[model samples]
Target: MDKITRIIAYAKTKLQEDLTGHGFDHAQRVATLAHQIAKKEKAQVDEITLLASAYLHDTIDDKVVPDVAEALAQLQMFLAEIEISAKQQAEIIFIITHMSFSKELEEKVTLSTAGKIVQDADRLEALGAMGILRTAYFGGSHQHPLYDPAIKPVVFTDKTEYRKGSTVINHFYEKLFLLPKKMNTKTAYEEALRRQKFMETFLTEFYQEWEPEKANFF
Candidate 1:
């Protein structure tokens, strides 16, 4: 198989059974979004590198693998076998490693045009209707509470604090609501605004349903 086809097959195999929202479907969606954004931006980005990074972004994530170092080593070997250029491999790895929201929250990292497009696409997945479903799926898989009035959202200063979230509803305030402003590309930024508005509507309806008695007050 060609390298791109092989990478897609590998990603599908790796994420086929994932229940925490980082499944193959999510990867595919991100890859598609990245490609669309790249074309729309008409920037001097490497489409192959961006798409490859999108497909493999979560493969070696600590959230998915018990040993990130080992997973990444294996990924490097796979890239070498596929005969991807060293520079392209580096670009893909750089985008995957730095694209995560938690990583971005922790430190500022500059990205190439390709990296920026991929990052925007990945972050876009964390908004809108799909974002809500993914959040619910992840929360359910992890046994996190759906909602709790007393468990207010906390401003996370680090990845640890972010992951220690007690309720899924708090995620809106903590991250989802903030993603629109963080988008890297103009096209994605506009799309994010629309999705962000949808999330707001969903949250409003959710609160009303959660407490019909307090709906008038809201």
Candidate 2:
């Protein structure tokens, strides 16, 4: 099989045990989204690096892997065994390690075109209908509440604080709603805005159901 296929298989194996939204399926969707965004933007990018980063993004994530150092070592060894050049491997690692929202919450790193596309794709996954479900899924996996009016969402200036977790509904304001403006490409921004609207509507209905007496329709 080609190196990209092997990389994808590696990611699948690593993410198979994930109960959070950052599973193999989510990685695959990110890859697809990255491809679509790349095409729409007509940006010159290293397609292999973009696809590999998209598929392998979560494999070494602290949220997924028990030991991130070990995971990174193993990933590097695997890339070498698969004959991916050191340069390509470096590019792939850079994209995955720096693309996440939590990482950006710490500091924004300038990205290559491929990295930007992959980043936009992953962020897009966190914005729409799927984004809503994934947020709730992750919250449930981590035992975070669905909502708590008494506990408001706070602005997270760093990854550590962001990972401390928040209510499912609060995640929309904390991260998801902010994605559209953060998108790297015009195509991703437009799509993200559309998805953001959907999530907002869902939240509106959710609030109504949560407090029927206060619902305007009542």
Candidate 3:
């Protein structure tokens, strides 16, 4: 097997044990999508490392590892096992570390092209119709209220406050809706729009379901 594929396969084995909504399956899909768009974007980064990073980005998120530092250290060590260069490992870790919007809330780090690609792929998973489903699924898993009339969305300057906010609808306002604007490439931006539309549709349907006594008539 090729090096990048081998890296992802190894990571996938550990991640599959979690089996949560945004688990290994989600990461694989993101990596696949990123691969679809990577060549067109002229970000002077390594593609294999970027795609590998994309697949493993969420390994420490909600699935395999709960502790961020521990997860990263573990991932770094795994890369080391296969003779992956320190420089390449650093770049992959940087993207995985900074690519998260949740982490962004806690700390800010400017990402490289590889990071950008990985981030875009991850964000796409949260934006569209499918993305909206994943968002609701994740928010539900976290016990977040889907809609709160009183709790409006917050405009976050970075990642810390973003993680601090609750409510699934607020997630759209705080990040998903803004992702298209934050995209680093045209293809990624266009893909963002597709996902954004899905999110809007989901919110509309979700709120409509809340109409008191309306369901009785229909």
Best-performing candidate as measured by TM-score: 2
Q: Global lDDT of each model?
A: 0.89, 0.91, 0.76
> How many steric clashes does model 3 contain?
6
> Once superposed on the true structure, which residue ranges of model 1 sit more than 4 Å away at CA?
216-218
Off by over 4 Å in 3: 42-44, 62-64, 157-161, 212-218
Candidate 2 on 86-165: residue-level lDDT in tens? 89999999988998888888778999999999999999989888998899999999999999999898888978889988
Candidate 1 lDDT tens digits, 26-102: 99999999999988988777767877999999999877777999989989999989999999999899889887888
Clashing pairs in 1: none
Look at candidate 2 and give me any clashing residue pairs. Answer: none
lDDT for each residue of candidate 3 in 23-97, tens digit (9 for 90 to 100): 778888888878777877645668768877888887767444678778777788888887788888888877876
lDDT accuracy of residue 118 in candidate 3:
81
lDDT of candidate model 2 versus the reference = 0.91
lDDT of 3: 0.76
Sort every candidate by TM-score, greatest first.
2, 1, 3
lDDT of 2 at 14: 92
Greater-lDDT candidate between 1 and 2: 2
